[model samples]
Target: MFIISLTYKTSLENVERYIPGHNLFLQKYYDSGQFIASGRKEPRTGGIIIANAQSMNEAEQIISEDPFYIHQIAEYEITEFIPTKYNENFKIFIED
Candidate 1:
């Protein structure tokens, strides 16, 4: 599933505060092979995370760990995506 997370900043400090949690969460997912792809949205806006998980419950577990959730720094739209024809070479970015 692909989870697209967005943030509405009440203050820049809130955004800063949320960084730690986001970093930790991303590290966990990326390290665990759950994150297929992720990056900051354009104009340095929002977050886009592509995840592969066993179930929605597992996905939620990943979401709950994000720093944005801890600081209330962003809002997210978590959705389940069925990739019809994902380009393996173009889309895949697995760093070892």
Candidate 2:
């Protein structure tokens, strides 16, 4: 699993301009089972994405296709982690 953090580098005006396309990009990945969960941050500065990828390279390749990255509207920070423990309801997230 990977936690993808997006920090806006540009103004909201710039970010909004690409939201539609960005959403489409996100939806495509969600449909493909690459992205599990995603949403904007509390203060709306950026967003977060929980995804499954074979490796960091694969994660980067997936993120590279995001419209936000393509337009340089935000900077991305990816953190990879192993889910060793979680609630039963969360088990699905860690399953193979």
Best by TM-score: 2
Tens-digit lDDT track of model 1 for 1-96? 667677556666657766776788888888988887787877766778888876788887778777786566777788877666756673554322
TM-scores for all candidates: the values are: 0.77, 0.95
Q: What CA RMSD would you report for each candidate?
A: 3.6, 0.9
lDDT of 2 at 68: 95
How well is each residue in 1-96 modelled by candidate 2, as lDDT tens digits? 999999999999999999999999999989998898999998999999999899999999999999899989999999999988888998876787
Over all chains combined, what TM-score does candidate 2 have?
Answer: 0.95
In every candidate, how many clashes are there?
A: 2, 0
Scored against the true structure, residue 59 in model 1 reaches a CA lDDT of 81
Compared with the true structure, model 1 gives a TM-score of 0.77
Off by over 4 Å in 1: 90-96
Candidate 1 lDDT at 17 equals: 68
